[model samples]
Target chain A: MIRFLSILFILVSNTIFSILEIEILKGSDNLSKVAFVPFGNESGIEENYGSQISKNIEKNMLLFGEFENLAVNEMLSYPSSENDFYYRDWKVLGVDYSVIGKVNSVNALGNLNISYSLFNINRRIKILEGEIVGSEDNIEDISKIISNRIYEQITGLRGIFDTKLAYVINSDADTYQMCISDIDGKNEQILFTSKAPIMSPDWSPDRKKIAYVSFENGLAEIFIQDLQSGERDSIQALGMTNSAPVWSPDGKSLALVVSFSGNPDIFLYSIRNKRLVRLTNHYGIDTEPSWSPDSKKIIFTSDRSGSPQLYEISTKSKRKKRLTRDGNYNARGRYFPDGKSIFFVHGNNGNFQIAIKKLSSRYIETLTSTSLDESPTISPNGNIIIYATKDGSNGYLGGITLDGKARFSLPVKNGSVREPAWSPLLN
Target chain B: MNKVLTSLNTFFLILLFLSLIFSMFSFPKLNIDETQSIKVNFYELIQQNDILFDPPAANTLIKKEAKKTSAINEKTNADETSIISKFKINKLDIKNEITKIKLSKEREDILRVSAIIQQRISSIWIKPNSLSESLIAKVLINLAPSGEILNFSLIEPSSNTSFNESILTAMNKMTFFEEVLSLERKLFEKNFRNFNLVFKSSGEIE
Candidate 1:
């Protein structure tokens, strides 16, 4: 009888336990605050490299306005090692996470060893710890590596602090220079200078070379320039005019616009055998072709629907599907990093702005309110988009985070900048 | 000896049957009675707009009136059929008014406490946005009667590792719901002692 009573009691308890469950779907509007503490310097180092490295990382993490920072004066205590760290020090300041490190001298030959650790204040656990060994000359590079690791650990997304950007700079009306630089506008290098217009600079998959359209021969022709050797080679596709060259993900082909005689169409040119295959045959103009992340389909703009609209074509099945319908001008569609959505220049009421649309949905959401935005390029992590916009007749690069929480502009160049292209992440 | 063993087995079976019948009837009595439910319907049908906002003395007056009516019904003892029926109806009306206040008060407490728990979790959970995949996970939380969180387990994990990790990190940051202390002992044990929190991702770009 006692055993039978226990079985009945278990059944009765199970029913009561299953009755209540609460679902949480919304998140807080507040951003996570991170505290970057200045590292303790070794006795022999004279450069103050400890604070310099921490300052650089702080700037990089706050570049996209992704997180808030703690003021140095507000810190109750500055601890440089795991033994001295305390969760109560940051918890009282409402900090979500804290980063601390120490600088050590490896030897008398000026080599430095830096050890860092990241902690979650609320959970009271050490999340990450690492050490980097580099010379004083590579302090900037070492800072970038540490920033990437901390950012990835916090957000679970790939770190893109090392990616580069390629664009065109027209110092004068006639002199056009194609330039590449670090994403933060550092290490600016001019790849080529021409007396004609330069457009559509795209980095190859391996990032060793860049393919761009140059009119140096008094005609729109595509050229691939090697960064290390400074060598230039043309695609040499038989066409009267060619422009807008975008590399395929495999680095074996280029999706470009070619007008054989008069009509502009989309074609895939193989780089190995120099073979050109026609992908689109239409009386209407087709241009600005970009490969999907999966390389299975190519998204382009065409006038077949009476106005410029976005359409995608399957490379395998050759089937076509229209992506935008509400506005007449939806041009230069490029897929997000995941290939599940696309962003393009949306024109409504004569205002050209950056907008995104999921391939599975019909509605479009605009990200920017600028009137003359174009040539939007997404970061490798798909968290931000930078596009070219007009600032009182001088074209400059404007950027906005996909979350719509930040708006920023790149450093102004000596001339008008146009056609910003974001490079892929380094392996 | 075999006959005696068979008889003993039959006796045990009969005892088990009686226990099952007892457990089935006890649950509803502990939860809600039919009289209380009927009173709740009457209260909602008439006084739902006002809720429990009436003066406290009104409830006491109703109790006195109900007792007076019952006293009259007993004194009449079938001598006045119409009078007795009228008193019985008045008594029932008074009983319903009281239960209406009781049930709605308990329900209001439940709703208020549930909202606080949801808001607390949402504030602390640093949601990492993949912005590409739609996913959901469920976490079962166990809390002590003093409103301290005893344990939590991820019963249903999402396909994205980051999403699951964020949820677990958020749960670890919390040590107590403490708001449960304001709830009645029975309510806390029934609803919050062991409950599941369903976390969902909306796939918004933000």
Candidate 2:
């Protein structure tokens, strides 16, 4: 018994002392390379829909410059099925992932079936595969579905290709138009056109309507425009000025700014009963109120401390806490998707730029270098930020990935584009 | 009586365990004759010549015993103090030399290979963004002697799904480590055959 016990004890101790451990703290700064091969087709489609669908998916995946793609000419072979797909080909090209698909025949309902697969070359395994069915004419929608799946599988982030953006465009000195379009700046729709100025456009949580400040009525008023019906309604807020309307997470109320006798303070307006509740009653100027993701607190810009700084107020207790102190002008603060950090416009040495600050830390990080960058809007995934920047006296929308690795701008509109609001993702 | 026997047995068991651990890891022991030592008293040797020339003392037994001690002095022929003064050896210096020359050579091999493996993983791991919460995930890797990765498992996972997926994706991209081929076969089996990788997101906290 004694000898047996000693052996067991020695074995346990040896296992504990023999293992090795390594610590890794850094990650690659390079974007992953993806190869999108031209899909195959069964005997039913005529217009070469396979290539068109693959091309659209490729464009969507590379829209934000988060990934690198292998050119079609660089590919050695076009593999549409698993049998034809070979990992050796992609590995030689240094491609990390390969995407292939085949367009099946139309069904009885005239819906085309497309099957897609994504493979991790090094692991030699099919990471994702699925079939999507849609109308024959809606090929773009089907490609979006497939791209979303591939993106989700690879990056573990929600697919954001189908999301839209809302911004105000000024075509002329007098004409101000409210517009909503796809994130790629396609499928543009003019919701409201007025002779007065339009500002502070926001999307409701449900994404069925948009709430923005339109000055067409000779006073600053907030209007909710229905996307499908092109109908607009004003939420008769009790004030001389009601602007900066941001929807709460629950889609039940709006955290807006109201100026009562030149005192601009934040208020919450109920969309159903048109009731207004005072959230901030300070004599100082307070505006640009935005709700946290949890709807428990509202962060806004206030000059209560002798300068425009960011502050958050609890909804239930009405208790306020100062958020920013490093800069003299820190305003328009919005919580990140995760609610751990906040990004806002920070003015340093007379130059205004976009800056981010963690709630638990005191240091602030500047993201943009160009002065006059304002109205910064973050994607739902919190991976990208698009702000209004000016080039040669013309305002345009500029975007950058959160990692600071990629910077790109939206296609220049004929009019000056300002105040870009990213729409919420549809469930 | 029963309690005393059990206690005595446990004491012997503990002593045996301690001795076993020391023998396995400590330096080799040398066989030296510790019982016989040369004791050279400089004061007595200098006085012995003077006393021999002088008259005999009244206590003759004491004088004879002193003479006998002087005759048995083995170090009388050489100056032991001068020899030691010429070559002074620090007690701590020997211990330090043993660790520097004997232990560091083995440690240097593992350090060089571990750094290369760490850098390779860092070059392929595309960390996800906006992970504000500090997270740690551990992955266990098993490698063959040919420097090829045999298997890996996420033994520990963070609360964030995206963070965990990023680590797995990077690991899947690495197929061979080849740097391990330069390591000795014994060292490879002892340290690199199976190892744990601790990935930290807090290193890039903004």
Q: In candidate 2 chain A, what residue range of length 10 has the lowest lDDT sum?
A: A41-50
Q: State the lDDT of candidate 2 residue by residue for B89-163, as single tens digits.
A: 222334544666656777998999999999999999988876677889999999999999999999999887878
* DockQ each: 0.44, 0.45
Error of 2 at A130 (Å): 1.2
lDDT of 1 by residue, A32-91 (tens): 899999988878777788898898888888877778999988999989899999899998
Clashing pairs in 2: none
Q: What is the lDDT of residue A367 in candidate 2?
A: 92
- Tell me the docking grade of candidate 1: acceptable
Provide the lDDT at A403 for model 2.
78
User: Please, what are the lDDT tens digits per residue for candidate 2 over residues A116-157?
Assistant: 899988668899999988988889888888988898888777
